[model samples]
Target: MADENGETRRQRNERFEFISPELQVPDGITHVWDWFWQLSGRRHSGPEALTFADVGEWSRLLGIEVLPEEVQMLMAMDDQYLRAVREDQRAARERAQQQ
Candidate 1:
């Protein structure tokens, strides 16, 4: 279902919200998110694709230096999101098998 803003709950939840009091980077999070999607190939690939060299490449491409901590945070979040998606898929398959 969509909200008054016409954005579905899933879309809203999937929206990237960076709320870090520390590690304040002047750049917007969307850049990082987009770069990540491009790097990961829209989640068709795994987090293993997010390597230190790739992070450096992102920094160079963006013309800004990304801190190591920030890259770590992004990788961690990606891993967690992928794990949740896998679990959800597994549950859906089990339910379908049951029916």
Candidate 2:
């Protein structure tokens, strides 16, 4: 199925891999991910620095009301993503050192 933006579900999932596939509300999650990605320059630091007020501002800017649970989900996803990236970076550094 395609979203309103004509993006197929698979494409959307690929684009926003940080979002959980089990989410019943993928569209809202995608929006939140997109906004967070933009806010953070696609870096882990962006989500790490977010405050509750920033989330409220995000709601106002996106015109989408997100529940607190949704926010928690997003935060958890961000943490997981950050950890994965860090692990990948560490492996790359180790490989470079070995070479």
The TM-score leader among the candidates is 2
lDDT of 1 at 20: 26
Whole-model lDDT for model 1 versus the true structure?
A: 0.61
7-87 per-residue lDDT for model 2 (tens digits) = 654575578685645636477467666665554553434225455676677678878778878778667766776675566
Error of 1 at 17 (Å): 24
Which window of ten consecutive residues has the lowest lDDT sum in model 2? 39-48
Which stretches of model 2 miss by more than 4 angstroms?
1-51
TM-score of each: 0.49, 0.52
TM-score, model 2 to reference: 0.52
Model 2, residue 18: distance off in Å is 20
Candidate 1, residues 18-84: lDDT per residue as tens digits?
3424435446576666656565663334334456676677579868767677688778756765675
